[model samples]
Target: GGDGAEEEQWSQPGNDLSLPAVNQTKGKCCFSLCPGIKIPKVMDFLPNILTINDSSLPQARTRCLENGIGYREKCFYFVEDEAEWNRSETFCRSLGAHLATIDTWQELRFLLRYGGSLHYWIGLRREGSAPWTWFNGSLFNNSFQIRGRGQCAFVNGDGISSDWCSLMKYSVCSHPQTRPTGSRRDPEVWNLT
Candidate 1:
């Protein structure tokens, strides 16, 4: 008694509160059809399991020096330290990058999957009654909702959310490939698998 639409719906996140397809293995699904039980997505519970290792510290730093980290055309680096929004922005700039800007849900999911459990600042803000904007001057199209209330934005294991701009949190930075210097960093530094 399964329709194709239901299967398709299950494949997409938010359609049935399912974990994103990218995070699922071939035979493992994050959902179960129970009569009256609340099910959490894989993303909702993976934070505790995603801790960084002390050994990987050297490799992570090396990868940052070689290029950026993350899995995309552009390079991304996760600055695992606490700093205010402005200070975080300065730190990112110091590394020849800018605070992370998500242009699609894939990028967002990639960030969340490896972003650990802590809240991290991203490149978004809403001034007064104005709409949110990324650091690169593009309008935030609201591909995802901010989970809390405030003007600044951050991403956690669950997803993106709004918070106070002055709060100190970890941050991710992005170095674009199309910069004037014409340098392209390998995006395969971080193993998404």
Candidate 2:
């Protein structure tokens, strides 16, 4: 009673039919479905597996602490104003923290969720190299899925973007001791100007 088109539509990759009738109707067609179709189990478990792997990395927790502005689990708060990339780095360093260097999607997402409205400054900049670079002078290699202007970077609930460092915006900083180890003893607090 079913045609190939119905089978194709029902069995398409990423298509989930929760309805009992649809599932029953499509169950028979699953046999002929393309092998390339992404299984729900794989889709559901892949992120979890990746998250576990990411959390196990030495840099991940440190990066989180940095983004948290020395607060172990508290999300980093941003200033109301902004400054040039160099000044921002100096500001963070004065506080014993540095500009945030995001290396994972979870980190980026956390930043975006915490940073509301204000376009915070990140460690990314384009100085000598044609391509952008992080505060440590490393290449900016993350795949930020957004379009924007300027050389400065910020991560919202979505992803990172390029903006002018000189533009006044809030920013997030990290503790220097929390580098690649997520260890922090006493964080130096800076008075923002």
Clash number by candidate, in order? 0, 5
Q: Worst ten-residue run, lDDT, model 2?
A: 184-193
TM-score of 2: 0.50
The reply for model 1, stretches above 4 Å from the true place, is 1-67, 178-193
TM for every model, in the order presented, reads: 0.57, 0.50
- Model 1 TM-score relative to the real fold: 0.57
lDDT of 1 by residue, 98-174 (tens): 89988888898899988868888998988876889998778989789887778889989889888888888999888
Query: Candidate 2, residues 118-161: lDDT per residue as tens digits?
Result: 67788888753378778888887756753476777876655677
lDDT of candidate 2 vs native?
Answer: 0.54
lDDT of 2 at 45: 34
| Top candidate, metric TM-score | 1
